[model samples]
Target: MSRQVTPRAAPFRQFIVKVHGRCNLACRYCYLYEGPDHTWRTRPAAAGPKVLDQTATRIAEHAARHTLTDLSLVLHGGEPLLAGAARLAAFAERVRERVPRGCVVHTTVQTNATLLDDRRLAMLARHGVTVGVSLDGGRAAHNTLRVDHAGRPSWPAAVRGARLLAERYPDAYAGILTVVDPASDPVETYESLLTLRPPALDLLLPHGNWTAPPPGLPGRGTSYGDWLCTVFDRWWSAGRRETRIRLFEECLALLLGLPAATESLGTEPFTAVVVETDGSIEQVDSLKSAYEGAARTGLDIFRHSFDQALNHPGVAARQTGIAALSAQCQACPLVAVCGGGHYAHRYRAGHGFTNPSVYCTDLQRFIRHVASRLRESAALTSGGATR
Candidate 1:
């Protein structure tokens, strides 16, 4: 058994509320719906007013106790907009009204961009909610796997929604999120997304672990790392003024010995928590891709406080920093930078999460690549030349 590390007392600052439990589109690679966990099916399809009210109260209590100045409320779901714009807006307002004075809530809704129309965007904006859209890539061909339940392509509607946000509601446009597809041309993929004029980009790795490997991952291959490096070079070479890529930027920050935290990098405490539509409090949703019940905390807003959820073994494990890593991981030079490569990606069958990430080699390769670029840039600067 892995050693138990003392949990951090860090308060949760990011709350992902599952407003609706169902999605209109059935993307081929959706881990939450198709993964081992079936908890969503048992929960309410949408959060009833009662659940929302109690959840908001609980959130406020936690924030007040911790004296948090700023928090993030991400209205998430299989697709959050399915809960209706007015309902979502009202819920955001309620939460804002409930939070303690001076506690600023940064509200955002992560959607597939298929349901974002003029009316919906207007309502969300009025409620002070920003929009984050998920896309495989900007090109239609890049989004071939993102289809609706009827097996019809979602790119057309999705593109329209994205364009609408950029054109009419730029203030509400948070960014575009893309899951890296190693098969696609990395530079081309990055450039295509730039056409959407997103203020930022969130490039993510597909969720996977040793038990069930991610798509396109071979026995010993760094295809994913190679893909990331290709994009990193393009972004870095361009002076990185195109837009922010969260993953790459976080990597750079960690390498520079600065304080940074992301699911994919850094030793910062994981301060994000989730609230199911049925009022259950759980760990981050990414654990669903690891195994069944991987994210369950056996706690709910009705009977438990967010502080109690913080002590759950799963939640604590993530916040323990380098102590939660495996023997091999702890001995590694890149341990601090990678932070064991996301808590979920470290799971192995019988050993639980006490293992190095399945993406260990890939992380090493990518981290070194970024470090080398940083060194090159420093050298150029010292030599009185622009990189």
Candidate 2:
């Protein structure tokens, strides 16, 4: 488990690169746009070609220094779709071309679904990219939070776009991602998404840290947990043969003596680093919610290369900082499974990311459920017995 060099993931095997800062829609819950910070107003609308070139070089350096191959580099944004075809395609090509010998690349985009079409799919597919469309759930559940500035529903437009991509380039489109409203009916949302039958689904909790609990109904702070359990019940009962939900799957894996794929949701450390449009680098973009400029780094992607940015004190601090947080988390019974929840879930202004999970009790309950199942499964494996 040495940090120097091991097949074990390096604190984080994936980097969520924020290539562009502009977005097509104005979802109320967006961590980047309206959730926490307003810094996007100052960032360049899109990443210029110079920023793109330096970014690739930096990622290549990090890969070589770390001796990592086959890493996950998620292209994120206010909406990465805003980056346009030419710039995005160039970014992809840079990674494909410059990453070091051991650094193999797999690319994916998290989009708002408005701009997804055959042309976009073709560009992504040409680079062997996978696409993840963000939809809040069914129309009612989705339209409530995801809307244009004029207060119009974006569900129809997004769904139409998704269907177009699905119909035209099914092979390149990966899945659907919905942000759980905590108030939306998990059963309804789950079934609706299941109907679409996207290859994968990601149900995300609203972005928040300890300083600010996620947006919740007036008195129902724990609704997020309740919602997840309902999904868990069906997600398991459905057998997960064709449809895969990352969060539930991670929870199930932890319950079954298996490891989780994502560090943010499980025992893995905060292995992700993000680069915003202005070239500044930082930890999780969700932190942008905790403070005005939570995700800022001194280096501009335009001026400095990715290597300098990656090793920059600010950049390295995010990773090094996790060690301190792990002490509190490592001892909790649920820690092994919840992994201290998300980085954003642990933040508070004065104390600053040094608090218990915002979903503390919520995660505790779910861990009990997962642990109970683990105990039962272990007993069966040992002697076909139930404890």
Name the top TM-score candidate: 1
Q: Which residue pairs collide in model 2, if any?
A: 12-271, 58-306, 58-307, 209-344, 211-347, 279-301
Cα RMSD, each candidate: 3.0, 4.0
Q: Kindly provide the TM-score of model 1 when superposed on the true structure, using C-alpha atoms.
A: 0.97
TM-score of each: 0.97, 0.86
Compute the lDDT for candidate 1.
0.91
- Which residue segments of model 1 deviate by more than 4 Å? 1-7, 385-387
Give the worst 10-residue stretch by lDDT in candidate 1: 1-10
- Estimate every model's Cα lDDT from 0 to 1: 0.91, 0.70
By how many angstroms RMSD does model 2 differ from the true structure? Answer: 4.0
The digit string of per-residue lDDT tens for model 2 on 219-275 reads 335677777777777776666675888887788777666877563456543466777
